[model samples]
Target: MDGGERYQEFDPPKALRPWVRKVWTYACPSPSRTIQRIAPDGCPELILDLGDPYEEADADGVFHLQPPALFAGQMTRPIAIRPVGPVELVALRFHPDGARDWLGRSLRTATDQRLNMTDRLRDLSPPAGDPEAQARQMIDWMAGQRRDDWSIDPLVRTEVEAIHADQPSPPRDASARRALQRRFLDRVGIAPRTLRSVIRFRRVFDHAMAEEAEGWLSAGLDAGYFDQPQLAREFRRFLGCTATEWAREQVELARAIASQSYKPGGPEPG
Candidate 1:
């Protein structure tokens, strides 16, 4: 990471709030070429690489260069990325149930995959400028892409809200649970239980980063884990590492970016 590196998130415009979570930018005038591990958070992303393209390692540890524009679908595991040069990119993070509308496809088709969107990039090309200006351009393009009849499944939205709020999910019989799972696969790209687990892991990660608790055990407990072993299992499941190991490996830029706070569907700060 360079001293010039920065990561900032901006809220989506009011009309697009239901579909888009946030528009964000990451830039580094001179990157240090460190591999950063990005853990899953249950949201799909549209990433436009405005600067040098990044190298993403596959499951077999083979590094493949990414396209200038791509759609990253719901990831069940962590991915490692290394900057090939100076880095700058604008990203649109869609809510779990929101992407299927903009993408015009089943979310399940894109799960754990980064699909090339270079052809679609022509319409989204940003003029040379600062990241904020580029981000505005991207957001404006997304606004144009919005359809009048676009809408998310009401049941999916309700379940997503429950997960984020850390509230007990509504009681469901086996048949209801199966029905919800089908809807979630089509709209959210993951099972309902998987989403819940990911959100819970996010709380633990945030707590650890904030140092709000004495240790990982306390943080996990605060995040609703039954015991240390359960927390450790989640850590390995989401991050592919223990809690302490993940913290130890976080680069300065990753740490700083992860520490920022924002509530979903809230008003964007000026």
Candidate 2:
């Protein structure tokens, strides 16, 4: 067996770049039960479990063993993952609008939910082999379905970019905004306002983490929040904890786990 942990990211083939982010893999040997907390990010994910199935704890503390292959929608709250044994995961992260285009289905069906993709994966000819092989097969499947002029709606794409790049302002006109919200829901799975909230919360969290000395107010302002109180409210709403509490816990387990995989000849995680 390979010693220590292994985690790496690979760029998708040029043809798949528009809809897909990078392909990444992470694996670590069996260890005491460990939980990794992932905060909401705007991106959705398609994941294949290459090892033992991991248990997922939702916001309400209910746990379920994840399916072998599943698609995760845009996360709105923190989700905790507890690995049963060894951990091995190969993931294909899609751009906010990318999965909608490739799936050719309303992303709304899977928003904020995890759906089993085992049957969909099994339908492909030449069964998936390993992590890398499965990713390639998935890419090929998407490639086969691509059309000559495949593209996300220009308006949706623009809005998605705007949400991520700067403070997402509500449309000036309420009626027109409602219409766009409906369209965004159809094309993007989640409501545009909700997506904006998730992105804004992520920005604040990341800023606070990166600049601990700047104080939460500064971090909040930098991330477009109105003030420190607003930032704290968002922290509790999305993360189920206050900024100070979460930072004190330093449950940045995902990054720490990934770092373990990067260590050369380092001991396997436990």
Best by TM-score: 1
TM-score against truth, every candidate = 0.91, 0.79
RMSD of each: 2.8, 6.9
Residues 207-239, model 2: lDDT tens digits: 444436367667568767887677778887777
Model 1: how far residue 188 lies from native, Å: 0.2
Worst 10 residues of 1 by lDDT: 261-270
TM-score (C-alpha, index-matched) for candidate 2: 0.79
* Candidate 1 positional error at 250, Å: 2.1
The C-alpha lDDT values of all candidates are 0.80, 0.67
- Model 2, residue 82: C-alpha shift (Å): 0.5
